[model samples]
Target: MQSKSGTQKIIMHIDMDAFFASVEKALNPVLQNKAVIVIGAQTRSVVACPSYEARALGVHTAMPVYQAKGIAPNATFIHGNFGKYRTFSEAFFEILYNYSELIEPRSLDEAYIDVSHLVTSMKAAHALAKEIQNTIQKQLHLSVSIGIASNKVCAKVASDLRKPGGITIVHPGQEKCFLSELPVEYLPGIGKRTKEILNQLNIFHIEQIANMPEKLLIEAFGRTGSAIRAFASGEDFRNVEKPEESKSVSRSKTLEEDTLNTHLIHAEVFRLLEECSLQLRQEKRNCDTVAVTVRFSDFYTISKQKKLNFTSNIEKELWPTTTTLLQKAMHIHKPIRMLGVTLENLYKTSQISLFDYPFSKVKNIQQAIDKIRKYFGFEAIQTGRTFQKV
Candidate 1:
């Protein structure tokens, strides 16, 4: 589609088909065409990804494993291996990098690539999309669905319309027509609550949203209403942004069993803190904010954050704040199901200051420990605070 600047903008959104399950199938030929469901490490973990075969039987991502089992009794359930999936993801992006530099990664399994400068016509864009799909399939042994359109929003919508190696294209000047008959939920940023509200207004399709008065929508959704209407009318002007450095690092884990034991919960939080700190140090970054999140057995989640006086990647420097945030977040007094730690406001680590001299020795010791872990393993050394029995 031609932009206001009179230049054609061709954006392609590529989404991997059941990425985790597909990777597992690629690793084992026997899993091909089988109903596979990948779950998390925890006993009460939910489905991380379900293959099309399992999905056909009503199994879906985020559904509890037990419920998925009830729906697809014959499905093969496997614990997801993030490390292996990351390896494949790196290869996937490497191939995309060869096609265009203007790529925005939505997740490990999906990305939007701006190919405006490469393809001159709709035919050329279609050919390029197919080429990318074939390249990924041939190299990674995994299928991908692609969507080509003038903007990111429409492209994302088009990509989901097809699955398992399908390409859907919305040519320039056809964005509104392409979205009209689709459900309102097809538009980005329209969540379950918003869909319910729209349904209450008898607005079921994109065409209804596109035709609704801006004033009434504004009265209902406030300032965001106008943006929703614009998207519904296929008037998105957002560009495919280039990838940026991570602004935060976080680690979370679901417990083997829900517990009210404060000590055990503290131990899990500390373990997550250590993991986040280690990651920060490895990235040569430091965070000025520490946050803790607690999830109760009833699925109620709360988070608390505190800003530090100085940026630090050391576990010792950040632990005090992390603990404080955890205590504040756990005020609900319910059985905790998961614990998470987040280190935010990240920046490249600077040279230590004179004011930090008191912790310089500690930093050296921590660096030495990091070196040991690098050569040996993370479990080779454990702090006393992180050791506890459930």
Candidate 2:
């Protein structure tokens, strides 16, 4: 379809079919064609992903494992292995990189690719989509659903229409007609609450939303209403953005059990800080802002941040700021359920201060520590502060 500039744009959205479960089935032959549900290791973990078979039986992602077990009693429940899934995800993107450099990863399993430069017509786009599907199926033994449209919004909605190895295409100038008959929920950003409000207004289909008065929609949803109305009409001007470098680094952990012990909480926060610092140094980035987050047992979360005059990736240099932020954030005398450390306002690392020899020495020590941890594991070396138990 031609954009407003009179240039043809073809956007493709690819979503894997039950990604985590599909990966499990691909790796273990025994899981093929059987109902599979992937869950986390925590005792109170929920289903991470459920196969189509399990979904047919009413199981879904984020449903409690116990509830899923009751619904799909005979399904095979497996603990999720993120490392294995990441390896497959890397391979998935590697294949997409060969098709187009203008790719935006929505998640580990889904991405948006702009193939406007490669294909000349809708037929060519269909052929390219089929080729991509075949390549992924042949290489990964997994299925994907693709939606091809003039823009990202319609493409994402179309991709979900026919799932599990299906390709749906919306020809140029047919975006509104293609989406008109679909439910209002098919439009992006329409969640349960929004659907309830829409239902109250007797708006069940995308066509109703498209025909609504702009002032009424704005009144109903504030500024977001305009965007929702545009999406319902299959109008989205957003481009497929290339992946950008991370602006911040963070590490968080849910404690085994909530506790009021300040020592243990401090230790956990320090451990997370260590991880974030290590990641920053590895990326050759420095952050001038440090933030701490604490989640109470009641699920009440609070965060505090402090900005420093200088940026550094060394844990020792960042710890004082992190500690002060943590102390400020943990003022509520409640048992802590989780701890997180964040480093922000990042920039490429610059030359170290020549006059600050003490800071230079500490940086050298941290680099040595990073190399040792890279060869050995992170647990091979631990500071006294991180040695405490929860």
What TM-score number comes out for model 1? Answer: 0.77
Write model 2 residue lDDT over 1-390, tens digit each, in one string: 475567789999999999999988998879999999999856768999999999999998899999999999999999886556756786899899999999999999999999998987889999999999999999999999999999999999989999889999999899999999999888989999999999999999999999999999999999998998898888998999997989899888888788898888889899889888887877788888899999999999999988888888888878888888889988999999989999998988884532247556766777788877764446667888987762
- Poorest stretch of ten by lDDT in candidate 1: 351-360
Q: Which ranges of candidate 1 are over 4 A from the true structure?
A: 1-5, 260-337, 349-390
Per-prediction CA RMSD (Å)? 5.0, 4.6
Q: lDDT per model, in order?
A: 0.89, 0.88
**Candidate 2 has what TM-score?**
0.78
Model 1 agreement with the true structure over 278-374: per-residue lDDT tens digits: 8888778888889899999999999899888888888888888888888899889789988899999998888452226875788888888877665
